[model samples]
Target: MYVLGLGGSNHGFSACLLKDGHLESMIADERITRKKYGVGLGMRLAQGFSRNYCLDMEGICLEEVDKIVGNDLLVPTMYFRLQDKIQLINHHLAHAYSAYYPSGMDECAIIVMDGVGSKRKAGEEYEYESMTLYYAKNGKFDVIKKQYGYNLPGTDYVENSLGIFYAMITDIIGFGEHEEGKTMGLAPYGDKEFYEKIRKYIRYDNHANIEFNSSDIQEMLQLKEDVQAIKNQEEKERICQKIAWAGQQILEEIYVDIARYLQEETQCKNLCIAGGVALNSVANYKIHKKGFYDNIFITPASGDDGTAIGAAYYGYYH
Candidate 1:
């Protein structure tokens, strides 16, 4: 059977074709459009992607494809082009499937974390979660837990997002939006004392779910304001680097703690991690070194762009 998968969100937009359980062709919209992060996909781009990649995969006809799958968050938008062919896959389930299947493990614990997933109507503080955990065994999947971050209605900022916190720090350091890697690289040069101050702001529940208080957000903004007013370039760089270090420290600690919790709960030695945050090598390495899992697998395409792979796997198996 030939299956076509599609994914689209604020971070990346992509598509993939799978034939009889093997990848036939996969293409991210950013590669074709030359736009970084590949944020949006209108009907035109969706149709073009399908016609060029999905329909032509190894001479497979679009009509011959058995199923068309889409990320749960993107399927409604995709309905115009795919019509009845499209089926929805949950956001976190897609991420877990993407990581677990690609890891080549028969069983594993999966963690998916990103900025946001699903849509929110007004007055819904937790319309979507920022992170989730799942256990997969022999092609079966079960949700262990999912954590939410809160945001007020009509506000651009989420009060409890590590992704947003990192992105805000990236901007505070004068890096353009989506340039989180620059901050990660600069983190090692930062002062240890500053990192301590930043790490204290993060608190979590017994399930390893994270939340940030209003005071923490205000303090972060104040720090940004302070850094912005610095007169010396060296001083600014020093402070920004410190902030980056602190951010990385918080991220790493939270990831390790969550992984530890999962290991304790599941007793599974194999772990699969996905989402944009999984791209942070520092945290990934720390999680590996913590000895919670005998083997750690992170998908090559850990970001939102790779959700197409997960959507396809969901369609094929589920």
Candidate 2:
């Protein structure tokens, strides 16, 4: 079977062609065009494809793929016309399956917490819309559960994403988003004062859903902004440390609560975690050390890029 997996992402558009469960060809849009993320190249390539020349998947072909995937799917502009032969896995499910399938675990708990995914509403123009999760066992995959938290009204589920929350704080503290690992390293230098402040913003319920009060975060941001008035470098570093500590603490608490609840509900010792949040290696280490599960497996490409693999795996296995 020839299965083609495609991913639309802000970082870059990617396509993978799988032949009978093995990756045949994988390429990113940037490599061929010499552009960073293949921005605005989708339509350009689509026009190019009309000429009937064999174009490499990297250059303008991204735009062709995007068109095939649909503009509404948040695919990058470069992937407008490429066809995806395999079953398309929703962004979250792609993350979940990529984490679970490779582990070779028969029965394991799966958690996929990402910034955002496709949103649908029941009884609307479409029959149904939902954020879905799947469970695989004995070579069978089934929709075990779904989450609707992202659809809650009046929430900045995309831009001010929880994943970006950690990333933004990392940037404000003089670290790059790619350098978030530094914030994890610095966590040992801080105390729990900021952690106490962050507790006021998030509340965990019996269902393991984390309720975030926006006003609390706004208030804290205001306080931190004021602290930036401090002229001394040492004082500035101290303020950044406090903010980082708060973010780290909140992530730990929320994940622990979810992990505990999933363990109780599923009674599974092995846990597979994915999504942009999974990139927080420190939080990951904490989850492991806390013994939330006897074993933890994280997808190496835990971000949206892994969705390509997830979609292909779901297509083949299902």
Candidate 3:
């Protein structure tokens, strides 16, 4: 059986081909198109297939694949040409499948957390979820819980997001977009008092829900402005490092708490993690050291790039 999986329409357009349950070829559209995240590389995805695998998208040749799966159902048809051949999979489900299927564990608790994903429920018009929990056994997965960014009672915007919070801190420290690792590296040089002050704003309950009000984000924004007022470059650098440290500390706290809560609730010794946040090696180590789970597996491509692999696996398994 030939199954082609596609992930695009948001960021990181990619394609993964699986032949009889084994990976044949996988390529991210960004690598070929030289587009950083492949944001709108939709119909052009076939170009990636043609370049990487010597395949073409012309009529009659496209039927070689028995099935095609894709992530993000709402991709614009104008940009995606394979609408008839593609089956849609939930964004977080793709993340979860990517982590758990390759862990080589028969049963494990899987966690998929990112900046944002498809809505919490289908066709509900609700805010997107930030994380999802699943239990995998016998090659089947079951969702245990889902957590989303806080949406005001009557509004469509989500104001509270740990992922965005971390990204904000990364930007405030002078790193460009997606340069969060630099902020993590600078955390050790900061003071504990700064972390204490920041912790008051970010809150997460035992249910794995993260809540932050406008006050929390507003205070951080003010600090971004305050850092610029310092006359000495050294002083500005010091303050930025402190902010990075405090933000990393908060991120680690929230991650560990969520892991602990999952372990307690699922009682599974094997754990799998994915998403952009899973790329935080410092926090991953902290979770491993906490010893909440005996075995913890994290996919190497934990970010959006791996969603293509997940889409393929979901199609193959189903």
Candidate 4:
């Protein structure tokens, strides 16, 4: 069977064609359209797919595949309709499964953390929160195994996301999106004091499921119109470093704790991780050093785009 995976955020989309469990061809909508995220390029591409291909390897027609998977051709929208032949995988779950399946590990604890996933209702919090845990064992996926999520009450979940937190600090430091890596690089130069202060904003239970208080740093800072008046360029750099460090620190602590907890609970030595946060190389390095698991695997395309692949895999395998 041929399995296809697609992933990305608002700025772009990526698609991977997998046949017999190996990646065959992968393309991004942005590349084809020359648009950063391929915002409106999907329909054009779907039209192209229809004209170009015949007898899609999966016993489905190109028109049918396009109809079902091409509905949400725009970036960041998950409304794609791929003729219902391809199973839809939850964006994050795809990240989780992608990591696990490729790792060749039988039993393992998986953690997928990202800015957001297709939104799920959480009581008064209509917006989605991060899902930090998903465990795979005996060839099945379980989301309830032990998970950590965070959302600020009465606010859009993205508003308080760690991904957004990092992105904002990156911009505040004058780096913009391209400079996010610079912020990450500067993190080692800072102290942990900022992390201590930010910790007050995060609330989580014994399981490490998180919730941010309304008075979190982002909200508190927004209250002051001229936040820059007090925080100059140097201060902003410090803040950026602090934000990077804190985000890294929290993820490491939580992931390690969760790994240990899951390891103990499931007695599994293999671990896999996906999602945007899994892209945190610093945390990945730390997790590697902590030696919580005999092996760890993280998806290379650890974002929403991978959901397309996950959806395909889930459809074919499950």
Best by TM-score: 1
Across residues 176-215, which tens digit of lDDT does each residue of candidate 2 receive? 5356667767766777777766566556565655554445
Q: Candidate 2: list runs displaced more than 4 Å.
A: 25-76, 83-87, 122-134, 139-146, 149-164, 171-179, 220-224
Count of residue pairs whose backbone atoms collide, per candidate = 0, 17, 1, 16
Whole-model lDDT values for every prediction? 0.78, 0.59, 0.76, 0.57
17-74, model 3: which lDDT tens digit per residue? 7778887777777777787776655566545542244134322245677887777733
lDDT rank, highest first?
Answer: 1, 3, 2, 4
lDDT of 4 by residue, 13-91 (tens): 6665555666545555555557654555544544433112223434454444321221122242433444454334456
- Model 3 alpha-carbon drift over 4 Å, by segment: 39-61, 73-79, 120-125, 150-157, 229-231
**How does candidate 2 fare on TM-score?**
0.75
Would you give me the overall lDDT of model 3? 0.76
lDDT of 1: 0.78
Kindly report which residue stretches of model 4 are placed more than 4 angstroms away from their true locations once superposed.
9-12, 33-87, 122-127, 145-156, 159-180, 217-227, 230-235
RMSD of each: 2.4, 5.5, 3.6, 4.5
lDDT of 1 by residue, 2-26 (tens): 8878876655778888889887888
Model 2 whole-model lDDT (C-alpha atoms):
0.59
**Cα misplacement distance, residue 30 of candidate 2 (Å):** 5.9
Candidate 1 ranges beyond 4 A from true positions:
40-44, 75-79, 119-126, 153-155
